[model samples]
Target: MLRSSIYHRPKNNFAYAYDEETLHIRLQAQKGDLQDVTLIHGDPYIWENGEWIYSTSSMKLVGSDDLFDYWQAIIRPPHARLRYGFICNDGKESLTYTERGFFEDVPTHCHYYFAFPFLNKIDVFSPPSWVKDTVWYQIFPERFGNGNPKLNPTNTLSWGETPTQSSFFGGDFEGVINHLDHLIELGINGIYFTPIFKAMTNHKYDTIDYFEIDPHFGDKETFKRLVDECHKRDIKIMLDAVFNHSGYYFEPFQDVIKYGESSKYKDWFHIAKFPLNPGNQLSYRTFSFEPTMPKLNTENKDVQNYLLEVAEYWIREFDIDGWRLDVANEVDHHFWRLFRNRVKAIKPDAYILGEIWHDAMPWLQGDQFDAVMNYRFTNAAIDFFAKKQTTVEQFQNELVHVLQSYPQHVNEVAFNLLGSHDTARILTVCEEDTNRLKLLYLFQLSFTGTPCIYYGDEIGMTGGDDPLCRKCMEWDENKQDLELFHFVQKLISLRQQSPAFSKGEFSFHAINESLVSYRKTLGDEELLIIINPTNRSLKVKFPTSFADSIDLWTNKHVSNDLMLNENEFVIMRKMK
Candidate 1:
């Protein structure tokens, strides 16, 4: 037994409140160390004759990474509080584990056990129930479509023209309305639009007006119609919120520039100097040294009220379903809490997604954002699947870290994406290999969390980062990759029709250097996905014998020995 490798805690992902009544506890041990482990737990106050009376529940070996095996137990304490310990057996001997570390004998006192004092309902990490099953399609509105050329900005270029940072091709809400069938046909249930608020740039990250829709994108009435159209089709809309900074033309920032230190709105932004210098990044804190965007002082009461009111106005008036906060990590935590409360008061099921690129445990504790754009998931998948820069073992470990970083609820709604407006298209990243693109989509759609497909990604569009990636949507069917589109459509269709896709417990295995296999199990329903990332044929042995199983891809019965061709994959599900 590797005593030093045993690990557990009564907080975060290890032991967390699945709900007001249930607590999910997990323990970690060195891989292949313990044969059996059991949870010994009881209410902290449940003591008889100076001895703590407890119940024992066997823990399931959920998963194993390169170095550790994860064990989990779901318990419902009678009084919503628990003092727990673990008993491990390696076949030769047994040992008792507690808060005080290893002990030869089980401790009788409650203090010797780990404690979950109370399972508070408010602290439970609850995101929108709809988000877990949602298949999000991220739309960069400026480039998606153009249904209303009359609303185009002056000197707008023709559609499909080469894109520059400031270029516009007149993509309007009417255009999106016209293309609703495209998304529907592709099976998208959620839309995440980059900022549509009135802004200077086509991308709209630099907000000029929070309340008004960009005329280039259409009027507020058109946007409301768009919202109504989406809801009618059972699709949800999530708009971007750029509260971290304001554009150079933003009213408050303009006022600060005009009046310098004497402006009443001076407190709204972080203005370092009396004479405003818009060209220098040092004049005031901006969004990553861009002088055009001045950082907002979210700590100000007026600023908080203004932003929160803007947040409330959209939900109350437009009935927008969600807010995808831009540069969310730079914003203050208190403001987000206020924003969450205000948004939830209007719509309790509203998803608050943040654009945070790193570990975001602090912001996802049920008090602030529901989940961040899962860039960690993005980078790992790219490194392993797209770039081929990481070994299979390393890829599995990286993903395990991501899954273990958050509670189960957080992972469920995590905005997992392969590419977005901010990054290069996945096809381009794979060097235009349609085979590799297929592999990427297969992994993403089948993995845990709500997966997002960037606009044009499903149709095999390829471009580099930023301006190049933000090209106009190919309206011509002949130019689009219909086969790839159909493949993606099939994946989304499978996800919607199966509970295991979104609700199952996910586990990834390092099958070999060239093949990846993962399983999703929900009760007796289980799906095992195997992929071959190389150009050569590969075979994966069945992880276990299934009583009755069928290959979901070919819709045929499968055998234990299966050969997968280059860039080929299979989703095998157990049959009743």
Candidate 2:
């Protein structure tokens, strides 16, 4: 046996309480080194006649990455406490593993095993339940619509003009209010807007003021009306909070620049040296070397109080539903923890989504963000569906790794997206192949987590990265691809109506280089999703036995054999 391959830690993702009653435990071994693993667990205090009573549960091979195979099992400890160890086996030999060390046989003493002292309900990661059901629409506010052409900036180009980083098309709160019916028709239940606070640029990531809406977007009353209108339609609104840094022109940063070391706000930012220099050369900390965005010193108490007030003021004043924090990874955890307390106190169900592009396990422990901008999901989808850089098996493995990186509840509410303001549009990334784009959307809408659609994505808008991706919303019915829009609408409707699509257990049934098949099962309702990413027609076998099935997409009945056309996908529901 490859005993050295066995690995386990008693905390974090490996072993953590999923809820007050349920405990999730995991073990990792070198890829393909172990045939199976069994978790032997029980309460540490439960001893009768000098013997510790225990229960054994088989651990399934949940996921495997390039180097490791992950084994997982969910257990319920009667008293909310657990002592556990693993029994690993290869085809040829078996070994016992425990907290103290590896053993030849099961240890008789309970002290030798790992222990979870108690499961605290307070520590369990709990995001708002509404998030799982939400279909998010991400809007770059300045480009969404021009409801008030009067508010257009001096250099504003006509609507539908290609966007530049500094272009202003006068998309305001009134524009969003006028288009509530459009989002309603699109089946979007949640709207995530980029930074809308007063700022110099059209994109508005750099904030000049946190409390007031930008003049380009609208005034306070206009925003309140927009929030009211959205709530009437049952659409939740999430505004962006850019607390990681402030714009160069922000009052505090400007004061620092003007007064140098004598400024009372000198400690508000990270200054490498006094007499601030705003250029390519090093001086103060900035966001990605951009001198215009000076990083905030969140550790400062005054800074924390100011930002926290900004956090609570919006929720209390506008009745906003959530906050999507920008550059959240850069902010101090202490500030976020306090931020969570302040926000949740006013609205317990308010969703806090962080803009974290990478692994966010550290911030997702029920203390900070409810979810993050799932850029990992975007990268994987692009690699598999757009770039064809990975095989079906490899894509499935990577996806499984992502899912297993967090608890099941966290995975359910993860903010999954295909394109965003920061990246190339999905259509552009797919080389303008609408078929590939459709396949990508099909997978995204049906997969786990809360799926987000970048504005203009469903309408077949295509552009390159950054400023290009932030183009104006195409409102002309004649120019929009209504077919693609309806297709996406159907996907959203299916996600809403079917429990199997939203809350089902996922497993790959069959996988290959060109085609992949997966199943989402929840009790009696089972759905099979099959995709063909290649250009040639292929005959793919159904991995599960089915007598009669209806294609959820087209309502076509199927029996025995299935043939998929080039770039086609299908979701089938088994009929009893």
Candidate 3:
């Protein structure tokens, strides 16, 4: 029976409150070991005539990785308290699993079951509801466009020039306003700008001032205009907040450098030694050991107030839609809690996205950020679609692990991205193979979570990591890959048109070394997504139930035995 594989816990993703009335319970068993599981649950206090009451609900196999199969069932307790246990059967054998241990037979005692205690409404992980339908477009402001060349830095190079660490091309808010039509054409509903605040570097992570826009980007009026313009076009704007650290030249940090001990603002940062050392030795904590970027002491009351003011100022002044926190993990939880409260108070529906590259359950508990950057999803996609290093089964397993790591609501709104300012562009990652990139986009757009497209990705811009990836947007029609652009646009259109793409239940129905297929079902509307990443053509046979299906991508009717070309993919809508 592989009894050792059976596992459950009372809290976290294993079991959680989906809402005030609904409790989500999850059980883990060895992959393919348990034929089925039934959740034995009820309000722990519900009793009649010297006997406790309970009900049994079947648990569906929600997801599986390399080692474990995750089983889930949604239960609504009338009393908002839950006591639950599992009755697992593996064809011939059956057993009851509980908090204490396993039982040969179903345990009747309430003490043997796991208890949720009570479901508090405040404890529910309620992120902004609008995030599920959002499609984000990430823009590195300096590299996006040059609307006003007059505001260019002294050594600013011409647009489309090869980029270096120090080069700038004066991409201002006006440029973004000028190109709103392009984004509208691509069907982007949200824009995430990487650190538009005033800073020393072209990439403005080192915040010189939180309140003002970078000169290269534009003034506050220009930014406000841009925000209004974006809102007018139904596009939400999310600005990056780099509260984890400030630039070396920041006034408070500079004061510390001037008066090591007596500076009133000395506690604003984590300064270890008296004599300020910028580069030689690590005198103070910095972002990834870069001395120019001094880490902020968020725990201090003064620093917290300062950052919180920054958080509220943007929404109150410019009416920005959200804040994408930079280095959000390094910051303390207390500050994030306060930050969420302050931001939500200003704009309740404002989206808060954290830049977390790994497991972000701690930050995503509804108290802090609504979603994270979803780098785990990005890495898995790159490994399978770009690097070709993982098998389809392995990729699906990795995805299952990610999906099961969070609650259903969190997963729906998670910030899914293929390429960003940090990583190499998607086309470059796929080695300029537009076919492979197309397949990657197909999967991302059809899969769960709110998908994001990096700036210039739709037009097939290709570059390597960091400075290279942050190249100027290719505005020349001759240079842009319009075919790829239309393909991405079509994918976004499909996502918007189909409820199955955004809010459907996701399940991988078929997987192999070369082919990966999944189904998204919401009500009667079903979407079957099939991707072929290999170089050889393959004949994919669909079930007789899918005999009448239409390809959403091409609007053509597909037969049961669909012959997919090399590196081809399709989104088929099942006919009613």
Q: Give the Cα RMSD of candidate 2.
A: 1.5
User: lDDT by residue for model 2 over 1-576, one digit each (tens)?
Assistant: 777878888877888887778988999898999999999998888888999989899999877777788899999999999999999998887888999988878987789999898998888888999988899999988999888887888888888887778888888888888888889999999999999998999888889998888998878989889888889888999999999999888999988888899999999999989778877786999999998999999999999999999999999999999999999999989899999999999999999999999999999888998999888888998999998899887888788789878877888888999999999999999998888889999888888899999999999999998889999898999989999999999889998889898777777676455787788888889998889988799876674565467888888876556778899877889733
lDDT of 3 by residue, 1-576 (tens): 998999998878888988788888999899999999999998777888867788999999998999999999999888888899999999988999998888988877788999999999888888887888889999888888788888989988888889998888888888888999999999999999888888999998888888888887889999999999898989999988999999988889999998998999888988898877886788898998999999999999999999999999989999999999999999999999999999989898999999999999999888998999899999999899988899999999999999999888889898999998888988998989898888888888888899999999999998999888999999999999999999889888888899997778899987345789998999889888888888888998876777768888788988977788888877888845
Q: What is the C-alpha RMSD of each candidate to the true structure, in Å?
A: 1.7, 1.5, 1.3
By TM-score, the best candidate is: 3
Off by over 4 Å in 3: 511-513
Report how far off residue 364 is in candidate 1 (Å). 1.2
lDDT (Cα atoms) of all candidates against the true structure: 0.89, 0.88, 0.89
Global fold similarity of model 2 (TM-score)? 0.97
